[model samples]
Target: MSEGFGAKVPADVERPDRVLAGLTARQVAILAATAATVYGQWWVIGRVVPLIVFAVLAGPLVVAGIALAVGRRDGVAVFDLARAALAFRMRARRLHTRPPGTGPAAPGWARERAHYSRYPCGRTGQLRLPPHAITDTPHHPAPLACLDLGTSGVAVIAAASTVNFSMRTDTEQYALIGCFARLLHAQTGPVQILIRTHQIDLRPALAELADSLGRLPHPTLRAAATAHHRWLSELATDTTLLTHQVLLVLREPTHLHTTQPGFTGAVGSGRRVAAVTRLAQRLDDARRTLAGAEITLTPLSPEQAHAVLATCADPTRDPTHGWTHSWEHTP
Candidate 1:
């Protein structure tokens, strides 16, 4: 008996003792508690139930206990799992119901009829209304009316050319700064300056260059022109050129009285025209002020103003595709 016990087992041999193993200690306790609860219910009832009836009553509890105890190895205790499941179920139920006072105001009968029309199964139907249908409320503001010089009452936009600030001497830069200061100091209303930098598209420039190359008279020069055009084509693909635009926004005086009260009791067209004229004069003054500092300012046309707004609204869009000219300079 001692020799048989001491003998070593081969590595490939199966271990018969490990087969038919029972549940872990925690799983056994959970299953015992579930069984006791079920048995207690049956005893209280004082009846012998069918197997199917017993399974229907107690199957879920047994499955839940076993799953909580042994299904996962993520180190979460059984009670935490049960709490998480309860919370998840509560959230699902809340999401299925409509919040109070969100949908259209209607009588209970109308709402019930509409619901039955959409879902004929009454309360048992699984059809669900989209959240947007219940929650969406749209309110659109009135479109802005433009006055002379494309001026809106809130702001005036002016296109300005950029000077090489980095290359200017100290004295020149100081003069430029002084000029800007005076420009702002002259404004009785608010002033806002917006600077936009965008990638320049070179397709038109390339086309123009190609057209110029076709007109070269001398053979050697024509050959050289062809080579240069090829180089430009390659360069266009390899590099991106960028341009800057400056916008000068001047505010209109909101306190100015109208000649006649309009339907909205706001500023009348005559008053708006007068206000725009004043704003345009101020912009011209600014233009002259910047001109002394070697910067040029041009007023944007209605179409140009729309393009500028579109580019500003979405910076990633191609700035030059729609507009005939670049925003950085006048055509």
Candidate 2:
């Protein structure tokens, strides 16, 4: 096929074209820059340096330049990988739960005694992390259902129900696809669909079943419930039962930066309310639009959102319904 004749969306849309010798412009630039620098160094000081010593130093540098230009690690260029590795090494090794400048200060004697902390960098200085870079609860997380993604704008998550498309006929599938396409076309802002699989802990379920066994109307029903509980108990002890959940994330860029031309209009405290209302309306519209496809979108409450985030952060831990992750000022 000719270059412009392709219909399918290319997988790597950001991929740069190879201009010379199967090397992209960026690769060629890296190689050229490395060669130029090496040659410049040789031209300036080559007379004083031993021939073998220059060869040894220049050989490794040239090899590294070639590697950086051509080699890839995990689909990332070696240059990028090295830069990331260096960045990782330079960053703080530990993180404190507390944000900078809060909580009671240590006593003078205690401060003197513990002048050097085990991971002083994590404690003494502020290392920028998530939730901190965004809204400041003074950097502590507040009970916000939606995250104010700062420059990227505000975002919210909704628990969405899925449709069993595989069971539908071709005609039904096409209809559903058309409905879905309409949903996509109607989008006023960016939207994301995330599917997460979680393992169910059947022990608690078995316990609940065990508790309900005696409440059964018939002895036969009670026996069957007891048997089912035993089976679940066995399964819990043996293997994991996984269930997939669909979540819808809606995002709208506030363009709230005062310097930006878009922000010439006022964007103060009232902006948050307007943004949230807009998000909710969008979610509702999504719910109504996807109704034809039998997909439901239920906006998660702040507590439920926390639980979902907590669960996603650490899947091994059980989700809490009643727990409130508070970050209110403690004066």
Could you tell me the TM-score of candidate 2?
A: 0.64
Tens-digit lDDT string for candidate 1 (1-331): 1233244668635312322245556666666787788788778653777768877877788787777655654656565678798876554332212334544577999768877785443232122321110011112121222222222243456778877776887778778778987898889777889988876767887788888886888989989988888887887789876788788777675454433322223446555555656766677688889899888877665445556655775677775555321221222
Q: Whole-model lDDT, candidate 1?
A: 0.60
Model 1 residue runs over 4 Å out of place are: 1-154, 165-170, 253-267, 320-331
- Ten residues in a row with the worst lDDT in model 2? 131-140
Candidate 2 lDDT (Cα, whole model)? 0.69
Query: Which candidate number would show the highest TM-score if scored against the true structure?
Result: 2
Clashing pairs in 1: none
Instruction: Give TM-scores for every candidate, taking all chains together and pairing residue i with residue i.
Output: 0.46, 0.64
Q: Which parts of model 2 have CA positions greater than 4 angstroms off? A: 1-9, 16-25, 46-56, 100-144, 182-190, 199-242, 255-278, 321-331
